[model samples]
Target: MKGLKVADINKAAGLRLHRRGGEAPAKASQQQPAALSKPGAAATASKNKNKENAASAKPGNNSKAVRLPAVKAKPAVVDVPPAAAAVPATGNAADRCTESLKKKYSEVGDVDNESEDCRDCLLVSAYVKDIFTYLQQLEISAAAVRPDFLQSPSRLQITPRMRTILCDWLVQVHQRFTLLPESLYLTYHIIDAFMSSDAGASVKKSEFQLIGVSAMLLASKYEEIYPPNVADFVYITDQAFTAAEIRATEQRLLKQLNFFLGYPLPIHFLRRYSKVAAATPAVHEAAKYLAELARADYSAAHLPPSGLAAGAFCLARELLPSREGACGGSGWTDALEVFSGYSRQQLEPLVRQIAGLAVRAGDNAKYTAIRKKYSSSSGSMVSTWPELDGTGEALRSAAGLS
Candidate 1:
């Protein structure tokens, strides 16, 4: 929800620029009193010259000078083309948007410098507010048409473990492409949306991988600046799926969802609330680990993205050392509740589920990809932190669990 409304915000900002451009001519006209004064002065001078010429003609005996009429230069009309007039204003607006994006991406966490910190906070807040409104509308529309997994015909053949395996594979694909985190979450959403639809009811087990890959491809196209080609996906899967098949599946998936791909994802909320909490890199990494774990678990499909993000953040904070100068005050839960729109009681169940998934991921061999992925240095090795295992009881207690 936080990042979903970027398009709408951008449109509004552009409109504001156009409106300012339209007003520029009016302001310039108001400042041109000299134009009006120049015309009056010219008329007065012309009248005096005409009178003198007439007097000279009447009294002149041998004066043969021809009196030429003084023609006032018509006021120069400088016509400004609409396109040219709007160019500078549009450029200025674009520059501001670009700067905002640079600032948004440059700072991953809290800023220590006072002025720079405040600027970053304002940029992020404005961005999130716009996105939140857009996401609310999307949620309302998506809910009306959302498929019911419980009654889905595909649920008969597709087991939860199968879904986990497909999702785990998707995680690997996502990393390979270096896609945005939102892409992976949207990929899962697409897969789930398709599975719960009538079209996916008759899909064969052999074709499951095809569905997963197609979903990822579509999500990439939607969220990525440059999405990978169908061949790339086929190659990634070792040619288990051909390009033609992938394209066809893409069309099917699109038709099923009515081409509405923008859904509020957990990553969107996680990034916002993490900033609100002023979480450290380690806390963020740990939280991401938990969130991804939840992604791979089929049971988490029913949980709202915001709740899942809050749960992951709560667990992440419990797993890491507290920051000395965190801005969220002494009560991290309160900050999270306010920023994430979920109370502690509402977040407790989700937190418990996420924590349970974290614990199980460490113990289960089948779920090794996520654990191993996070164990690498690139992930900050947050998965291997001792506090993850050591703080189980504390985390449970904090979540209001027995």
Candidate 2:
């Protein structure tokens, strides 16, 4: 919004020009001619002054300055494709509730702090990307939106053992009756987002399916999606998770979360603002990283997905690799201006928790059993449970396929 100043540019160019009260334009000629007439004035001038005089006094010394056309530089506008639209924009009360939830997190203020630029956040975002990449491993394409299938399977060929790990983890997530399927899907989304961002972690073939499932478990309850069916979960794991065991772990997870399941996250708000602002490519990426980091933190048993997303993005503007190039530009600036009412301060604690979770998730070994199971179960088909027949709309809606 600031106007360009010609004087500032001139100063930077280091040209000494008399625009102010340095010397009157005619003062030098007036005094010099009179002074030079005096005997002392002739000798008083230095050799450099004589040279200047000689140069100025030359017959053909002066030449008109050539002027060229001044072309104004215009700002470039980047056209970015919108995030995949949700199944139908038509709103029911439940959809309205989800929208409200998005609004809640949208209110968090962004943090200007760049103090904690580190690999962990990048690693976490990359980790989330890998999970989504792993979804390609599922290789199950529903008839609807196959082309728009935003998630891709793993590029690095995974071992059969690793395959079992993923499936078993999925079962494990399903087994956690306390969590919802929507959260599980969200968890996968976060993992994919993270993994896709980080090249190394995805290449290392780190076992992230377990972490992904755990994070999903955390997200489901928060989103109020389909709660996991404990008995069905046990069946998926072949009774590996007893009712008592699942309940105990759920309790532990709840305690770890300080019993707060209702926290708003980054994805909901990011998508909303991104849509309204038509954010640039860079801010879109920053939002992606923030969203995944937020999701990863949910698995820590410490924070909720919504809280983490809010905090991460609040810090994201400061932390992303392109933060400087991305922030305060038309992209981010426009988004912020429109969504200025939103703040990131409310999510700081969650961001810290997510950063911590990113560290812990990297080292956690709870996925050993789940990974082993996932790898081994590929040849055998997972049993399809009977669903009461319904319209495609209802079915699609239930599976979030709508």
Which candidate's TM-score is highest? Answer: 1
lDDT (C-alpha, whole model) for all candidates: 0.64, 0.37
Residue pairs in clash, model 1: 5-131
lDDT by residue (1-402, candidate 1, tens digit) is 011122332332332221111223444444544465465888899899999888877855567778899999999442311111111111232332233333332343222222254466656643454465455335444732233473454345767777777777677666656667888888888888788777767777788888888998899888876677776766666556689999999999999888888787878777777776767787887888889888767777766676677788876775565532443422245434433444455566777788777766766876466777788898888777765642466554544554
Q: Give the per-residue lDDT digits (tens) of candidate 2, residues 1-402.
A: 011222333332232221212333564444444445677765667766988977877778885446899999999542211111121112222432244334443453221111232245753432332332232222222111111112335344333335334533453433233333345445444433334332313423333333333444455546653443444333443433465655664554455444644333335555445434444554454445434433433233223233333344444444433433545422233233223222343333444554443333234455332223222333111111011111223222322334
Candidate 2: segments with Cα more than 4 A from true spot: 1-181, 185-232, 241-266, 276-307, 317-325, 329-402
lDDT of 1 at 293: 84
Worst 10 residues of 2 by lDDT: 379-388
TM-score of each: 0.66, 0.28
Q: Quote the lDDT for 308 in model 2.
A: 38
Best by lDDT: 1
